[model samples]
Target: MMVRTVLLAGCVSFFWTGPVQAGMPSVSLDLTDIAQLRLQSISFFLMVLLLSALILKLCWNLLAKDFPKLPRISYKGALGVSVLWGLMFLFVLTMISGARELLTPGAWEKSGRTYRLVEDKQPDDASLAAETTLDERRRKLGELRSALFMHVATHQGKFPGKADETTFAKEFWLQPGPLQARYGYVAGDKQADPSEPLAFEQAIYGDDQQLILFTDGAIKVLPTTKAQDVLNGK
Candidate 1:
């Protein structure tokens, strides 16, 4: 009964340590302090040993029921097996963590004393606003593409001419906004090549990227220079 109680206590301690460590304040390790580092290493090793012992105890209990003639594991024998398992587990975990840090350096950022994952980093307001604006522009362009197609279907396969902005606006319920003002339309019919650029945004974005709508009703974002070449019929 005492041995069972000890095993239960070890299991509880092993599982509880993770959350407790996670909740503790982040401490910057002093590379010069060998004694402190050694203490931390020893604590980690002992925790792993206890966890391995608990796992072995559970496995022995399960197997003993099936193998009735099997001799029970002595404390010393269990300790030896636990140490081997613990060492292997620690080595594998260290390798994986080291590989991740080396291969994807940008995935982690040091903030104050702690390393934070890129996913956990919050976007600043300016970045958030820019992303929102870009999304809105894309959505507006999509709606405009649908409206142009509707116009083509009704007007004998021709899109609205550049001279008929008022007619196009009223027919498509398009409001005067950044999207409508910044984007230029090409006068073309449905018979034009499907990959031909039908409309494109001016190079107004800070990133020098433009959104283009094709005759086939596809929208794509391209670098401003390439988009300009396409617009100029090159």
Candidate 2:
């Protein structure tokens, strides 16, 4: 009976209980520290309780011969105790699984398991805002270029004489915005070869950092002098 009990326990332990891991090397974990996470919610806790109870009852029946002197335990009471044990285990598992997160005063403990940042770093709003604005400007310019390309495709091979400010996202057309002001439009019925032609460019960035869009569907950043030379038939 004892041999069978030992064999049964060994099999269950080998198959069921698995290893649990925590965080990176930077985050330390210990057994006794309070877990900062909720391992099981209400529904999951109920499920685990019922499953633990079933296993406990099965084990009790199987090991009855080994412990013939043991007092009889009602299945209901044994199941209730098993559920309580599961709740305690759920709480401990959280402690073993430490988090690599920002530490706050309310949750921070002076124990070896708890870690905190020495300094607080804030974002650079000025640079972030500048980057966001630049991205928006770039998108607007691309949209305008696309609309002009579509116009030329169906308008007998001629680029739009003027950018329509009121043109917007009605369906296939992209909207034009104030960014169009940077572009110096050329007035002509049609240019036989617009392959190397300069449609418009942005001079807002810098004299040497101008974003120029070409007629050949190529966009490049060039110096103001070179771009002006291209415009002047250089």
Candidate 3:
């Protein structure tokens, strides 16, 4: 009975905790595409650390029972530990460098945008900085969109009748999703053009449904059927 109770408690805790990420769609940052690259870099480094630790732990478990108290650990064991440590240190250093670069004006902003306005310009530190500014603007736009969505829900008792970059930037900067112009919502016939990737939805992020736009120009629909497994992406 005690074992069963503990199991039930564990299950409950696992199923009900943390941020309410339920019914949230996975939004891919498409604008700059560089943000995706940055994410990939971070993800790969984390994977290396996690995989190394898991392999080392398993090896230690398997070898511990067979080996007696030894004066020295194997070279392979030391190498494995060193590799993990080195990867972690490298990741930290990379993050510090990236943060420094982003702190510069227009560097972080250039990260997210649908198109590069400076395609003709030669690639340089300044050009890259400009791209970062665009990226930051895009993110701010997304935040503002989300906030406007909630406001529309609260005051109007529904989503906005129409959404544009201008109206959002003008109002609710102090409230949710406040930023410079970035997010865009098209309504009616404007969204009817199938040649374009656009949709007029009552809400971008909803209780039962969440809409996510990827830089790849794909829209993903995420359902919150099981709240515990929400937003993880199938």
Question: Who wins the TM-score comparison?
Answer: 1
Question: What is candidate 2's local distance difference test score?
Answer: 0.59
Please, what are the lDDT tens digits per residue for candidate 2 over residues 51-112? 87787777886787688986556679778889788779978877654542333343543455
lDDT of 3 by residue, 6-111 (tens): 9999999899967765686787655567777888889998787667766766677678768776334454665578686797998998898677666653344343
**Candidate 3 residue runs with Cα over 4 Å from true position:** 1-31, 68-84, 87-234
Top model number, lDDT: 1
Model 1: CA > 4 A from native:
1-132, 163-166, 170-180, 188-192
Candidate 3 clash figure, as a count: 19
- The sequence of per-residue lDDT tens digits that candidate 1 reaches over residues 1-234 is 999999999998988845453566777865667788789889998887777777787788679889999767855677888888667998998898789899998898778656778776576644543454667778878877877787777878777666264245643433223333446777644454557888776654457778888887889998888988888989
TM-score of each: 0.39, 0.34, 0.22
lDDT of 2 at 170: 34
- Better TM-score candidate (1, 2): 1
TM-score for model 2?
Answer: 0.34
Looking at candidate 2, the ten consecutive residues that score lowest on lDDT are 171-180
Positional deviation of residue 95's Cα in model 3 after best superposition, in angstroms: 21
